[model samples]
Target: MPKKHLPDPEKYELGEPYTHLGIPFPRLPATFEKNSVPLKEDYKMRSMDYLDTPEAYSLFEKQADLIIENGWKGIIDVGCRHGPVVDILMDKGYTDFNYMGFDTSAQPIEYAQETWQEFDNIEYRVMSWNEFAPAGASKGHKQLGQNNKKETDEEWWSRAGVKFKVDFHVDVMIWSGVLLYEPTYHLWFFHNMHNAYGAQNAIIQEPLKDQRAECWREDLELNTIEHRLHMYKTKYYEYESWEFDLDIFSGRRIISRVKLWQDGDSKWEDWVDTHGQLAANPHTEILPSGYKVIPYIFRGKLNFELSQRDQTLCQVALEKMFKERHSHRLADNYSRDKLHLGKMYMYNFVFDGDEPVFCSGVQNVTDKVVRVFSRYFAFEKYKTDGTTLLEKNDNFEELQYAMHWIRDRIIFWSRDKSPKFFERLKVKNELFSEWTVHPTKINIIYPNNEQYIFYTPKVPAEWWKNGNYDGFFK
Candidate 1:
């Protein structure tokens, strides 16, 4: 897939936050001297152009909906660039949320603080995950400190004037497009968020590269034994090429419910035993601090019943299709269990006799979009020697049928404008693409420097028409 074209960052001058095509976008400060914090080498400054993209707005709206649906009062957005998430949430009438935006880059956080100073409930902090040390190592030892005075969690929040009514627990932790660069501390960060901070859930979006062991054969051999062991320990699951890695950005987003265990906890031993089986070598050695990091699992996709009466046949056909198209080695992983955690969905096409003729598996990405993985036909051609031969290209019709079914039923927003299976579906006019207006409203803008109108399908009209979107204020 070709990468989506974005405005050049060099074209914009560094100054105060200004309107670009009528959208209020934060400007990158000329220097970081004011904050006395140098930018990290891995911190790549992003342009406000991303706000205009469909993916960005869709994710923002969806997350805000999730926050509201779960009744989560406090949210900590990690790597919040210029506080776009906060801005969107506030615009959606969530002013009561206890929102804290944190980022390693000082300039963005500084800009966010200045931009959102009017909101008493919102706070922006220039801090890295590595530097964050929560008050308590365990639930029993919870404590907070201020002005050289040690206080309990409640006393600290009360004295500090934080608006949260409950105990100091972050309901949700968001890491949007920031975890890929910090791969080394990804698991540790998740661990800390669940155990130290009071994050019950997390929304993590990262660039999904092909990090499978087979693909990293050469890289694995070149790395030190210790590094290889660590890689195997963490990323043990084998991923098929078609399972993910679809677009130019190659993004994989996951919303997970965090589960944590301490040494004394009843579930701690069970978790350790599971890890031992998954790890390279099982050993009796345990951490002296009793801090254990468990792997995160994505919430499963919502299951919708199909009209096909013979469900077992459909399952069998899907398994055969997986073996043929995807890796034969990882065929078992493509089964029911793998369907959870953003794996794949099997759509069966049954003909007149209630016979399953074709099946295609697609990955349901955040209920926003779907990516087709494998399309297969159940038919086999007989050769001159009376041997059966399975041809690949015979499933185009079935593929088209499945794609249309997904587009009409499951997908609210489509990444592909000109999909192979579907005709040209009209998106929003370019003039209305600016982020200044509410996602539901149609607002257009024309910048002075640009020749063509700047617009995007941030929120697809079809979604609203089909009653698919139930976001904030709706």
Candidate 2:
């Protein structure tokens, strides 16, 4: 048997307390500093004019929409030049949010203050990032001296906090078009603004380095030492953060949305605290031909090196089975190259002694319809030949196992991200409509002054038609 590295919920490692770490400045190409645009009246006008195009302002508006949609109420917009976000908020008739916008350019700050003076919970100030976090502004981070003593990096960060110099706390921060200017400290500034600073949510949009003009790319050099998104590798399955990326400007720029929290409740959700439960909790079933199918869950990307052989075996078996059934329409597509063995999130396979008879997997997060575009394969006796004469070729029972696994994932994700966020998100299944999750629920009240508004979405036993597993839910 291949070595299995299943998740241990009790031992979920939270890679780091703060991922947005401090880094030294890079060697620059003199042009970036010697020839930079001045932050003045003309710059402010160009910024305001840039908003005239939907493409320019849509980024800001989307951030606003997400903030309101997700129930986030505070914003600390870095590089808030001329306050485009404030305008978008006011234009949308939204007055519930508290916004703090700061820019080094006095002209833009003055213009924004004068333009939106009467608004409540809105403030603009002329402040430099240097003033916010002196270490991030310079060529490198130096030991900060505090109380006449050299502060340790951890102590410095603790005392320092994202170094924005603000007294109050805001759960969300947005950085739009802000990285374009930081040339050297772009990622450094980025790491500090998002979850690295303890913000519950972060939205960042910036030009892609590869897409920038050659001259601009050479001048506005970003650090190659680390990537903004790659910083997330250590944080995934530990039940903390979930993220989504967006393409902007027809792929010229990109937007990264990062949320640094998930439900780890032991009562409603115990998966986070105990990953071992996933493997221990198997969905076993007996096929009509009396072949037993068992499902085992694996976490993270499946190490393809060990499973590559089984994967190919399943692929070849599937193609042969399909061809025998005269189903070339789909059989031709079951090539070994399409197994996608390396991308499994919650991986499941029925490996009987290093021989994979069945396999299926799905990613942790789902788009539009909280559903899975599952990758599954199973070995079956398509023809009545040899000792497998009683075997059914379709492997419908294995497919149902895959469906059950998908439902398990959807429930885990809905609870982790909050089921309310997925009200319109459906559970779609192309193969079997009976297994699909319907968008209806019946409320139940708890006794003794208690109310469980929990959305306990279920896959009713009646849907199975017959007790296929001989009381599987039992």
RMSD values for the candidates in order, in angstroms, are: 27.5, 24.8
lDDT of 1 by residue, 122-230 (tens): 7777665543333332233332222334456455445432331222346667766665544444555555444334354565544333333322222121111112223
Poorest 10 consecutive residues by lDDT, candidate 2: 17-26
- What lDDT score belongs to each candidate, Candidate 1 first? 0.40, 0.44
> lDDT of model 1 at residue 460?
29
Q: Write the per-residue lDDT of candidate 2 for residues 1-474, one digit (tens) a residue.
A: 212122232232212221111211112233544443322322433333433344355666777776777776667887787667766766676767777788776666666676666665677876655433433234355322233344454554455533443433456777766665555565555544443333556776654545323213233434222244445435422212222222222124556666544543222222121222211233344556455443333344432333355455544444554444334334533455554434444455554444445554544433211213234444452223445422324334554454443342322221222343333233332233323222333221112322111122223233324322211111
Q: Judging by lDDT against the true structure, name the best candidate.
A: 2
Give the runs in model 1 whose Cα sits over 4 Å from its true position. Answer: 1-52, 133-168, 210-248, 251-474
Model 1 weakest lDDT span, ten residues long: 277-286
Q: Name the runs in model 2 displaced over 4 angstroms.
A: 1-44, 134-169, 180-198, 212-227, 232-251, 263-474
Provide the clashing-pair count of each candidate structure. 4, 4
